[model samples]
Target chain A: MGKLKLAVGVAGALAVGVASLSALAAENIRIGLIEPLSGPIAAIGSEALDNFNHAADRVNARGGVLGGRKLEIIGLDNAMKAEKTTEQLKKAVDMGLSYVIQGVGSNHALNIIKFLDKHNKRNPGKEIVFLNHSAVTTAFTNELCSFWHFRFDANVDMKVAALVTQISRDPGVEKLYLLNQNYAYGKSFQAAANKLLKERATDVELVGDELIVPFGKVLDFTPYIAKIKASGADTVLTGNWGPDLHRFVKGAVDSGLGATFYTVYGGIPSSIGGYGDAGKKVNLKQVTEMHENQDGLPEDLRDYMKSYIEAYESTWYPDRYRWLIEQLAAAIDAAGTADPIPVAGKLEGMTFPGPLGEVKMRADDHQMQMPLVVSTLTSDVPKHLIYKGKDFGIGFKTDGVVERADTTLPTSCQMDRPG
Target chain B: MEVFAFSLFNGILYGMLLFMLASGLTLIFSMMGVLNFAHASFFMLGAYLAYQISAYVGFWPGLVVAPLIVGVIGAAVERWGLRPVHKFGHVAELLFTFGLAFVIEEVVQLIWGKVPMPYDIPASMNFAAFSWQGLDYSAYRLFMLVISVAIFAALFLFIAKTRIGLIIQAALTQPNIVSALGHDVPRIFMWTFGFGCALAGLAGVIGGNVLGTEPAMAITLGPIVFVVIVIGGLGSLWGALVAALFIGIVDNLAISYDLSFYPLFAVFGVERDVTGIMQDLVRLTTASIAPVLPYFLLVLILIVRPRGLFGTRDV
Candidate 1:
């Protein structure tokens, strides 16, 4: 009986310890990092989680954000699917998440944005803040841009417009052929590009623009390439990235196609790093969703990146949008309160030093404005052919890239404002 | 002209792949009258197991061993799992198979993390055999074509020539009589199930590198096989072959062609390249049409001729 009493006492003590830890974690700004950890984009999702963890560690080590309140990150794997994302978003909200760090693509973001809008409407004072790290769909800010949702990366429109302006500036470029992934981003970007180019560049003939699957849907791109060649277009503008870009570029080269000027719309830092020296010959220019080199960024962001890199090493460093994660953490911090409602207020028109330059959320829309860098491949060779860093100019800094009426916009301001 | 030729070639290749998957499904359905939803999962299992085996040994060894292993497992499933469920009617059997597919998918996830297995084409089949006009097609696809054809020929011979084959054919028509004659009906059913699963497994072994050895591959491939079986007419092997090839060819051709007839309606743009809202409509139409060509064709055939092309039975 005495031994049993002692055992119960120990169990009570352990439970108290755990409760204290939870309390302490709650005391810190509890940010939610909801991403597809195990699904199709597991590689990107897990990496984003690690980066977020590193940034949180740094913030906590400095005695936490907002008066030593420490940053506690709770991660949930949405698995990059529509059903799983809704479940995870609900779970995150239930867990009292102040902010959510989402993945890079717009399709996933579109689902989350819709969910948040409904959630915000249901709970008037209690709103959930969405700190999007990688959702680059301009529609997020344009039409469906919620006050609660804050983007860290450049949207498709900005990235494309930047590329178009860059291409137009170049005297060698006469014609442009737009090749995009056959999904939402592809459709939206293609439409936007066609519309913008028609309005802007009258001299440049819009050659045969086509949509192909992002990855290896077609092993041979010969037909598409042949069409481009036939169109008399000297330059091919594409939005393919990561493994798809690598595979497509390699496939094109293997087919004995000559080195053509290529403009890829979205590239992550590591993908840029991977484009070693060999990319120089192809005239490959990369315009990414996020900034690559943090050293060139603002002081606050550079320091955050340094600390994050120190904490997580190169595995979760700039290679996987560490700055994007930092920007999300900052937005969560700016909310002051732990609840998502207050955090969401800090997100709208919230300007913070991001890894790129300045992350300013437009008051008219919730899309964050960040610089999209257009860099050329250097002599990094076959290894970093997709992500080489030689021709990286500060490039174009887009202002007001996201239009309010494009994606997600509340019918009126009276609908709901972040508390 | 070149586009048509290549499209036709692509169709044939795709058809052979479909045959590999559909033949197994047809055999299972025809013999047992149980629509085995887990057949595609078995095909996926074959691919993953082959990938693992090929990683250690060579592709050839994996190809030979994986199907046999899958066949054994399939036979075991029939004896241990499905046989008991058979008393619960065809719907229950189908639900059981559907549940099996779900369980298999989870098991696959547990075994191999929810990511595509890095199963690349073996170094031997990595290089292009030849370039047609200017385009270079993978030699592995050619290998897939030959093996599938050989398997089809072998299956044809076995069903037509062998005494057991004759017994099986007779059993399909008059099952009660064949059973009353005391010819071990259960064993024949088991063997047919095993044989069908083996064909699916063989396809997986070849298709793993081509289509990727991922859990989602089964879900992606499962419906197409059903389409093939339904379009081919349930009890006919020749029907399956023709339907599979026809569907495959039509799909490839549809995707290749730019489906834009906007000139008939719109005055602003008369472009052939399908884009905007039309692009989405075309994509949905193309995707839906690609997998269901056999079903559509089958329906048309059913309306005119109750028995499918080369099919003896009304099914």
Candidate 2:
């Protein structure tokens, strides 16, 4: 009788342990962040990761999706290479991570989308959904759009459209020079700029259109600056990012090229610190989703920025990833399962209150329609600047904000849905 | 005329900087019979060290001290890293340096966090040297020209006139004979390697501000330095100088001009609607081809004159 009682007690304890372990497993959803964690743009990747984690923490605090299942983010470094990104994606899948987020390079995103589509086809139940936070390539949503890939940030056309609207209004910009990196994204930027300029600002002359340097290769832009000055361009438009952007701005300042720079990525953190005082001199206009101290910003966003800046001593662009995650969580809850296919199905046409404003994930192409802000860099820090952690006396001053209604662009994507 | 003058000046300045880097690499390659692939990494290290040193000391002191620190590190690397692998032959030495380059980049990223340092021109030298045709020539660039020229003159005189230089020259030609003598040949090799690295470091100190001091700076300038030495002549210092300047000037001129392949095709009466590769070929401009010009020159020189312009021996 004593032996039987001891066996029964042990069995009960084992059963309880198994039950708790299963419960713990059910209470967490894992997401993988595959990005360039160690390269020229590692800083950008790190900042984005920090913001995502901060958003995850907030969600978990408010009782995570699907009846308090905590959101977990696992970061994997892609090293800014497509091959490495594919390897990371495979690794993430092997680790049972169904949801993956990547940005930085459009080529990487396109390749990963192809990889995921192939993988999903092979393994039907185990599908990985990619949430692209930053890569603004139009081809990702148009010609190469995958059911597996959903982009939260505005595409090149949308951002360029908003920029064109602002440029058309500005009487100062007469002669414009277009300088871009030689790549798919850069080519798209150039095409969009040409199309937008024809429609919006016909008076402005296209002085020079040059595809100057390969991405992450150029060390000096003085020669390029000399060409821009010689072109007699009053304004310059470029989609160059990372060191290319920083170096170009510095070269312009050093050479005393008085042309105003209108860029898609002028407000990167490295540019602010790298350009120093020269950054303040150039009329650097950037089309972004968010900037500190913009009027009519929601209080919740202000609080989120405050907490994020205080926790992580860096600034993040297009905090749309946070909203993307929120919608992802809602979709999971709505689907009643953590399966990627179901979650992806539920995410289509999902509307969520984003930091900028209300954002909708269009079912047709999986592109998020959200507000875009065009701002200029100034040395003046406003009193309402909630995200100022340690400003080098450079901050973005809001010029104009294009609403989500104005940011919608036609997509040629015919997404093949899973049965 | 102003554009021509400006491009020429900028090219010469860029060439002088290249020469500073290539001179050391040429010296090491000629003496050690080992291509120091990590030579540009040492240049990158110099910039980072200068940035760190400049934070504590002024830029002047940083400029003086950083190269010295780099020289010491180079000597240590020669004594420890390269000397052990030297017996494995040229391939081994090359592989070691190549591996060292990757290691150095990783270590640099760990320390510097992958973002460029605020290594700008000194405030005193920030003003324009002159203005012509509504363009202001940077005073800092002219300062670089003066410094590099001084270094070249000093190096030329030291190598030509000094007894130690004569010993180094003799050792380069007949290492076994020099080793048989009372003088320590390996010690000379070590010192020469250190000195070569120091020259690269000095180049880095000046080039960092202009090029932007980041981890990728080494990779950006490394291959170009090799091109300079190869095109000029592998072992000839004068050859390296001439090749660097020539390449630099041609590169700048090519970039400054916007001549397209479309015009050439039009001249040949090829008015057909082009698509695919042909369309891309037609759209190609001199500016687009500028970056590849050095490599093009390298290939052409190799095919035509394998010994290079002034090379006494084939590399």
Among the numbered candidates, top lDDT falls to: 2
User: Over 4 Å off in model 2, which ranges?
Assistant: A1-25, A383-390, B263-273
Worst 10 residues of 2 chain B by lDDT: B269-278
What lDDT tens digits, residue by residue, belong to model 2 across residues A255-315?
Answer: 8888888998887776666665577688899998777757777887778876777787655
lDDT string for model 1 (B25-88, tens) is 8777766677889988999888888988987998899999999988988888888888788778
Candidate 1 segments whose C-alpha is farther than 4 A from its true place: A1-26, A33-51, A75-95, A104-108, A118-122, A162-183, A196-206, A211-314, A317-321, A328-336, A339-342, A348-359, A373-419, B171-183, B256-259, B263-315
TM-score of each: 0.76, 0.94
Please state the error at residue B247 of candidate 1 in Å: 2.1
lDDT per residue, candidate 2, B189-276, as tens digits?
Answer: 8898898888888888877776778767788788888998999988777888899889778777877876777888888876547777
